[model samples]
Target: MEWDIAKKDFKRYLLLERNLSNHSIDAYLNDVQKLEAYCSFKKTALAQVDARFIQQFLVFINDFSISAFTQARLLSGLRTFFAFLQIEYDRKDNPTELVESPRLNRKIPTVLNIEEIDALIAAIDLSTLEGMRNKTILEVLYGCGLRVSELVTLKVSNLYLDVEFVKVEGKGSKERLIPIGHHAIKYLKIYLEEVRPHVPVQMGHEDVVFLNRRGKQLTRVMVFLIIKDLAKKIGLTKPISPHTFRHSFASHLVEGGADLRAVQDMLGHESITTTEIYTHIDKDYLQSVITQYHPRS
Candidate 1:
C-alpha cells in the first residue's frame, strides 16, 4: 500500500478501534506524515521500507532539535502506527517494536496556595454579567480539578448539585462523577438563575452550562483570556492558565492530607502514578507533619 493510503487507514483505525481523541489522532497522523516525508527523501516506497529506514527517519528528526518529550511522543505514535499495520496487513514485524523512546524529564506544574486562590476570586467584580459566569467557571475549575475542556463543555444536565457531584466527560469519552464544592454550587446557581437567564442563549447551547455575551458556548481561548485578565488585574506575577487552577486543586488536596486514591478518583486520573505528582507538599506542611508525628519531636 502507498504511504497515503496506509496513513488514511491508520487514522480510521485510531478513531474506530482505538477511540483516541481528535488531538491525539492529529499527533499520530503528523508522525506518520513525517515518516512519509523521510521515505520520499530516501527514494523508498512504503512497501520496500525496512527497520533501518525508520531508524534513519528518527535520526533525521532528532537532528531537527526537538525536545526529548516531543521526540518520545513522536516515537510512541510511530510505534502505534506500526502495530496497527502488523495487525491489519499481516506484516511480519513492526519496525518501531524495538525502538527506544528518549528519557523524559517530568516538569512539575505550578501550584497556587489557598490564599492566592482566594485573592483571585476576590478580584472578580460580581456586578458585571460576565463576572458572575467567570466566577462560577473559576470555582468549578479549582473545586473539581477539571480540565478546561471538561469545564467548557459542561452541561446543565450533568450537574447533580443536590448530591454535590457532576458527571465529567474526560479524555477518550470516559465519564467520571466528580464531587462539586458548596461554593461552586452556590456560584453556579447564581449564574444559572440570575445572570444566565437574562442572556438570549443560542440554539443548540440550551443545555450548555456556560455561555458568552453572544449567547454561544464559551471557547477554550475565552476561558484563558478571562483568567489572564484576572491575573493581570490582581498584579499576580505567577504565569497561570485555566490549568493552574486544576494543578492547585490537586496540590491543595494533597497538602491537606487527602488520600491519594481519592484525589485520583476526583481528578479522574487513570493511574495512581499520574496522581502522584500532586503530592509535592509545601515545606511548611512537611515540617508540620514531622513535628506532629515524629517520635524525635
Candidate 2:
C-alpha cells in the first residue's frame, strides 16, 4: 500500500481497535509521519524503504545536531509503527525488529531539594486566584509525581482525595494510582472549593481539575511557563521544568529509604532501571547514617 493509505489503516487501528485517545492517536500517527517526511525529502517511499535507509536517516539526524534522546524516541516510535503494520498485514516481517535505537548516555536529571521546593511553593502568593491555582498545581504535581500532560488532563472524577490517592493516566495511556500527601490534598481542596468555581470555563473542560483564568484546560506550555516563573521568582539557578517535580518526587523517595522497586511502581515506570536513574545520592547524608551506626569509630 502507499504510505498515505497505510497511514489511514494505522489510524483506524489506533482509534477503533486500540481505543486510543485523540491526543495519543495523533502522536502515534505523527511518529509514522516523520518517516514519511524523510522519504519525501529523499525522493523515496515507505514501501521501498529498508533498514539501511532507516540507519542512514538516524545518521542524518545526528548530522543535523539532533539530541540523542530525540533520535532514540523517533526510532522507537518507528519501531512500534512497523510492529503495528506487521500485525495488520501478515505478508511481511517487521524490518525494525532488530534495529538498534540511538546509543543514549544516561545523565541524572536536576532535582529540587526539599528546601527549594518549599521556597518555590512559598513564592506562590495565595492572595490572587491564579496564585491559589498555581499553589495547588505545584503541590499536586510534586505530590502525585504527575507529568505535565497528566496534570492538565486531570479530571474531578479521577481524584479520590478522601482516600489519599488519585488516578493518573500516564504515557502510553497507562493508568496508575499515585499517593498524595496530606499537605497537597489540603491545598487542592482549597483550590477546588474557592478558586476553581470562579473561573469562566468552556463547555467541555468544566470537569478538568486545573483551569486558566478563562476556565479552559491548561496547555503543557502553561505548566512549563508556570514552573519557569516560579523558579525565577525564587532565584533558582538550575534548569527546571514541570518534569522537575517528577524527578524530585522519585529522588526524594529513594533518598528517604523507599525501596527502588516501590519507587518504580509509584512513578509508573516500565522498568526499575529507568526509575533508578532518578536517584541522587547525598554522600553527606550517607556518611551521617554510617557515623551514627558504626560498630567501632
Candidate 3:
C-alpha cells in the first residue's frame, strides 16, 4: 500500500477504532510522517522497512539530540502505526517489535506550596470582570486538578455544583466526576451567575464555561498566559504552567495522606504508575522537612 493510503487508513483506525482525540491522532500521524520522510529520502517503501531501517531512523533522530522521552514517544507512535499496517493491510512483520525503546528518566514535576498558591490567587485583582473570571480560572485549575484542555472545554451542563462535583472529560475522552472544593465552587458560581452572563457569548460557545471578552471559548494558550502573567506578578521564579497547578494539586493531596487510588481517579490517570510520580514529590517534601527540622547538622 502507498504511504498516503496507509496513513489515511491509520487516521480512520485511530479515530473510529481507537477513539483517540484529534490532538492525539495528529501527534501519532506526525510521528509516522517523520518515518515516511526518512523512507522517501532512502527511496524505500513502507512495506520494505525492516528492523535495521527502524534502527537507522532512530539514530538519525538521535543525531538532532532530541530528549530520550520524545524519542521514546516517537518510537511508541511508530509502533502503533506499524501495528495498524500489520492488522489491516496484512503486513508480514512489525519492524518495531525487535527495536527497543530508549530508557527515560522520570523527572519530578514542579509543585507550588499552599502559600504560593494563595499568593498567586491573592495577586489577582477581583474588581474587574475579567479579574473575577481569572480568579475562578485559577481556582478551578488548582482545585480540580484538571488539564488545560479539560478546563477550556468545561461545560455548564456538566457542573453539579449542588453536589459539589464537576464532570471532566480527560485524556482519550474519558469522563470522570471530580469533587469540587468550596473555593472552586464558590468562585465558579460567581463566574457563571454574575460574571459570565454579563459577557455577550458568541454562537456555539454557550455551553462553554470560560469565555473571553469576545464571548468565545478560551483557548489553552490564553489560560497559560493568564497563569504566566500571574506568576510574574507574584515574582515566582519557578518555571510554571497550567500543568503545575495539576502537579501541585496531586502532590498536596499525596502529602496530606490522601489515598493513592483516589488521587489516581481524580487525576484521570490511566495507570497507577503514572500517578506514582506524586509520591516521589511527597518523598522529596518529606526529606526537606526532616532536613530543615532535624538537628543532624
Q: Which pairs of residues clash in candidate 3, taking residues 3 or more apart in a chain or in different chains? A: none
- Residue-level lDDT of model 1, residues 196-295, one tens digit each, is 9999999999999999998989999999999999889889999999999999999888888999999999988888999999877578878999999999
Better of 2 and 3 by lDDT: 3
Candidate 3 local Cα displacement, residue 72, angstroms: 1.3
lDDT of 2 by residue, 1-297 (tens): 688888899889888777677887787788788778888999996767778888887787778898888888878778877887778766276667667887788888988888999999999888899999999999988998888889999989999999999998887687999889999999999989988888998999978999988879999999899889989998999999999999999888888889998889888888878998867687678998889999874
Give the TM-score comparing model 3 with the true structure, all chains together: 0.90
Tell me the whole-model lDDT of each prediction, alpha carbons only. 0.89, 0.86, 0.94
lDDT of 3: 0.94
Provide the lowest-lDDT 10-residue window in model 2.
89-98
- On TM-score, who's better, 2 or 3? 3
Show pairs that collide, candidate 2.
none
Which of candidates 1 and 2 is the stronger one according to TM-score?
1
Indicate the residue-level lDDT of 250 in model 1: 93
TM-score of each: 0.90, 0.80, 0.90
